[model samples]
Target: MVVTALDLVLAGLVVGFGALVQGAVGFGMALLATPLLALIDPAWVPVPILVPAMVLAIASLLRERGHADWRGVGWAMLGRLPGTFAGVALVVLLSPRAFAAAVGVVVLACVAVSLAPLRVRPTPPLLVTAGLVAGVSGTAAAIGGPPVALLYQSASGPRIRATLAAFFAAGTLLSLAGLGVGGAVTVDGLLHGLLLVPFLAAGFWLSGPARVLIDRGGTRPAVLGLSAAAALLLLGQAVLG
Candidate 1:
């Protein structure tokens, strides 16, 4: 696909906005960028987006380093390895439309889980399970934050943001590796991702002030609303397509 100047500009802006959302909240870059980019070209989905996502996750980790939970991050990564393999298989097997629809369904389900009033302790087993879910979601759709985010919903904001950042840093790398193994990470996607880095940085920088304004209870409502809306939009697009 030809990379027009407009494509670059639009992609940059979209990524920037998504990055801002992620910075203020915890994770939504892929959820916000994927469907929009898919409209530009399907080639811009998982691989291209994952590049900036990894960058964003690292930046988030550094920004909120004090609140990271390394043990939980470790458990998540352990479960993510096999889930990453499963995600690669799904990518190789499913048609584009079918893949999109499946992703939409899973995202919607995750959002539903987030919105529920259920209480979940972050036990090792549950963390591993969340990690597995995140691995598949991250690899397949670049929207892996929900499973882990939902699990940590009742925690402090800093912990939630920082811990998620840590997990995503590792998870995004694994997803990229999985994509590489599947021959999905093309040169064009990488180049496009590089072009959007500046915008992502800008968004992350701007998020600091916004984060201060977000109240304690605001995170849950914001995350849940955005997740549900994004899932609905994804599902609607897949269904209509």
Candidate 2:
């Protein structure tokens, strides 16, 4: 498939904005960017998007390395192993429309849980479960942050961002490896991802200011709102397509 200039421009903007959100709130890039990128070009999902997401994760992690919860990340990584395989299977088995719809459902469910008054502690078992869910969603749809982010909604902004960054930085590699083994990775996807790197960098840089506002009691709302909006858009696309 030939990608037009307009496609690249639009995708760059989407990725840049998603990066800004993730950089500020700790886990929104994929949730906000994936459906739109899929609309721009279905081939941009998963591999291409995961590339930039991984880069942003590393950047975010380094910026707040001191605040990360390594124990939580370790537990999450444990579950990510099996979940990634499941996500790879879905990619190989489902049609694009079905996959999109499934992702929409999962995201919406996560958002609903996040909005409820239930308080969740990041216990080892819960972290592992969230990691498993995140692995499947992140690998299949490039929107893994919500499950894990939801677990840290009430935490300090730096901790939330740093911990998620650690998880995604490592988790994305696992997903990419699974995709490559499943034959979902392609040269075109890698090239497209590289093309979007500058945008990701720009967005991450701009997020410095936004981080202040978000840290002052804005994290939970941003995470829940962005997740819901993106999920709705994805569902609409699936239905329309």
Which predicted model would earn the best lDDT?
2
Per-model lDDT: 0.82, 0.87
Compute each candidate's TM-score over C-alphas.
0.92, 0.92
Model 2 spans with C-alpha error above 4 angstroms: 95-103
Q: List the residue pairs that clash in candidate 1.
A: none
Name the runs in model 1 displaced over 4 angstroms: 96-117
| lDDT: worst 10-residue window of model 1 | 95-104
Cα error of candidate 2 at position 213, Å? 0.9
CA lDDT, candidate 2, residue 94? 79
- Worst lDDT run of 10 residues, candidate 2, spans 225-234
